[model samples]
Target: MERIDRRLGLLFALPVSAILAGAFLAPLLVVAIFSTMPQKVFDFLHWPDFSSYRVILEQGYWRSILWSLGLAFTATALLLVICWPLAYGMARVFGRFTLVLTVLVVMSLFVSENIRLFGWFLTLMKGGLIEGHLRAWFGQGFEGLLFNVPAILFGLVYVYLPFMLFPLAQGIAMVPDDARAAAFDLGASRWQVFTQIELPLAAPGIMVGSLLTFVLSAGAIAEAKLLGGRAVIVIADDIETAFTFAQNWPLGSALSMVLIAVVGTLVILGLRRVDLDAIMGRRR
Candidate 1:
């Protein structure tokens, strides 16, 4: 019976495995191959060269790369700080009110991300909603709110907050109520209970959420384009420019592969703390 079940599982997984290989892995392989080939060449038969990678190392690409890393790290840190309290409240303190908040969070996911970003764009634009109101009331408003670093950061946080919040809430929810009670019974203060017990137990969620948020933020092109304008340039923007405007396939592929490596490393690190069974809701 177990053998039959195993066979069935494998059979069911075949389609998904094939799809991943064909759609994802195959393309990644192509990109890797292209990254090694001569610039502007689409043919895979060309001899591999390290010139593209050397160009990346020698050129001003570091500025965009560093900017991407800095933005991603900053956004991830801010997200953790913002989401931790909210997630804890939703998981433990909010009780019945948590249901409404959860529904709202999930509903936000149903809306198109681009539409939400565009809404932010409108609100931040000069003489737009917030700026117009502020100017009316105070006779002064932030003229540089749109097309700046803060706008990009705000957009990233708004879009990715729910991603961090969900995992954090889930992790916090898994902490037993009895554990908190026991901590209190042992004369631990609320802060101690949260810092030592809740936060430690929620490490898996923190790792996973940080990984997701950071990688997504680093690879974001739309947010930078729409909100940052020409003031900010991230690695994703550089990659897009190389692929589209520059028409340098090898350079673009090299940049993409670097991003893939960074994201992949983060995923591996997060997997160390993540409970796969808990995430998947699978039986051990």
Candidate 2:
């Protein structure tokens, strides 16, 4: 009976597992194989010379990678600071407004990201929405805020705001009210309570949110391209160029493998420290 049940469970799991493997694992496998091929070659007949991997450094792709990592780190840090108070309020203090705020944030997701970004592009452009209105009404105007590093960062923050906010609120919600009350009863200051009780208890969510925002921002090309005016060519942009215009699939695959390794290592190291039971609200 136990064997039959095990077999039945495997049968049920097989289809989804196969689908996931085909959709995800297969692509990574292909990239891994291609990464070893010589540059500009398409077939698998050649020896695995790892020439493309060397090309990453030879062609100065490392700079793009560094830029990507730096921007992703900055964006993630900013999101943490910006979202913490709001997430705390939503999880602990907003009351009726919580639903209102959640709805507003989620509404933004339904609109296409490119459309929203293009909206910002129009609004920030010189003599555009905000500037144009001010110039008309108040006779004051400013240069376009688009096509700069700050604009790129702003776009990153704006696009990924909900990603950071929701996870953080979920994390803060896991902190029991009794804990905060007890801390206060024991004469803990607000700062002390936050640092000692709230922050630690809510850490799992914070980590997840940070990881998510970092990964998304790291791979983001659209924000830099559309908003940044190609001032910074990110790793993703380089990969895209390699695959599309450059028509160098092996180099693109090599870049991809490196990115996957770095991000995957970070994720593995992060998940190792997170307590699943705590995040899931399990007693154990």
Candidate 3:
């Protein structure tokens, strides 16, 4: 029976694995090959000169890379702070209210992301909703909020809130209420209980949430472009410009490869805290 079950599992997994490889891995493989080739090459099979990487160094594109990393880090940290309390409420305190909150968050995703962002644009742009109303009512209005770093960060936080919230709630839910009560009974302060007991137990969920938020924020272009008004050019912008505007496949591929390398390393590190077997209900 065990052997039959194992075989069935493999059989079921084969098609999904094949689809992943073809649909996901194939393009990555192509980009990897292209990254090694010389510039302006129509074929990825061209000789491996690695000149595109040189252009990245010589042309000083590190600013965009730094901007991308900084924004992503900031956004991820902010989401962690913002979601922790809400997630805790949803996981432990809300009871029946959790369903309502989850539905609201999920419903937001049903709208096009661009449309939602554009709505913010209309509100934050100069002489737009907030400013116009404030000026009309009180004769007090600042120079709009969009086209700034803070606005981009706000967009990142808004868009990725659900990603962080659900994972954190799941993580916090896994923490036993009895354990928290026991800690309180033992005269442990709230801060001590949180740091020593709650945080360690919730590490897996926190890691997953932070990793997702960081990687997505790092690669995001729409926030910077739409909300920031090009106040900052992120690494994704550089890659897109290379590929589309500059028509430089090798350079774009190289930039992409760098991003993949950076994000992949962090993902691997973050994933170390998570237990897949436990998550899958197969823990020994």
Candidate 4:
């Protein structure tokens, strides 16, 4: 009877396992294949060469790379700063309000990122809401504010806030009430307790959330296009240019591989620092 039950469970799991292998694993195999191919090669897919990777390593791609890294880190930093207090508040102070707040966050997440950028574009344009306020205060309006690095950064944070908030709040939720009480009982200042105890316990979740925000912001194209106004040439826009105008699939593919390499390397480094047990415990 036990053997029959085990066989039945395997039968149920087989289809989902096979779909995962075929749908996801197969494309990864193709990416691995193409990452090693030459710039002009077409007919031969099996041939292995490091030429594509070499070009990626030894070329002007470095500038775009630095730009991506800078944007990603900046976005990560902003996300942490903005979400930390909100997440802590949600976990500690807003028990009955948590569901309502979570619903709003999820709704914002559902709104398309491109659409959000569009909304900001209109909002930042001259005579818009923000512009009206600035015009009243400083007399010089939103012209300088729109189509700049600041707007692009704003769009990035707006789009990625929930991603950072959700995980961080969950992390804070996992901290023992007793730990917080004990800290208070020992006469630790609020700042001291948060900095020393809460933040350390929440580190793993913060890392995961920040990594997500970083990767998303790094690859973002629409925000730079709509907000930066061609002034800033991000790596993602370069890839789009390669694909659309240059019509260079090989170069575009190569560009994408560089992004993949950079992001994958960061993720691997982060994974190495995370304790698996701690991560699982946070989920509980």
Task: Count clashing residue pairs in model 4.
Answer: 0
Top-TM-score structure, candidate number? 2
- After superposition, which runs of candidate 4 have C-alpha atoms over 4 Å from their true positions? 1-13, 40-49, 57-59, 132-142, 275-284
| Model 1, runs deviating above 4 Å | 1-12, 279-284
Q: Candidate 2 lDDT, tens digit per residue, 22-104?
A: 99999889999999999898878899999987888898899999989999999999999999999999998999999999999
1-284, model 4: which lDDT tens digit per residue?
A: 99999999999999999999999888666656665666655534546675766665677766777777887789889999989889988988988898899999898768788887788887887777788788999887646467777778887888888889988887787778899889989998998888888888788878878888988888988878897786677889988886578665556667787788889999899878766567566344
Clashing pairs in 1: none
> In candidate 2, which residue ranges exceed 4 Å CA deviation?
137-141
Question: Evaluated with lDDT, which candidate comes out highest?
Answer: 2
For residue 284, model 2's alpha carbon misses the true position, in angstroms, by: 3.0
Model 1 scores a TM of 0.91
Question: Please, what are the lDDT tens digits per residue for candidate 1 over residues 1-284?
Answer: 99999999999999999999999999999999999988877678889985788888899787888888888899999999999999989988999999999899889989898888888888889888988998999998777488888888888999999889988888888777999899999999999998988888777778778888988998987888888885788999999999999999899999988888877887787788778667545535
Distance from true location, Cα of 110 in model 2, Å:
0.3
TM-score for each candidate, following the candidate numbering: 0.91, 0.95, 0.93, 0.85
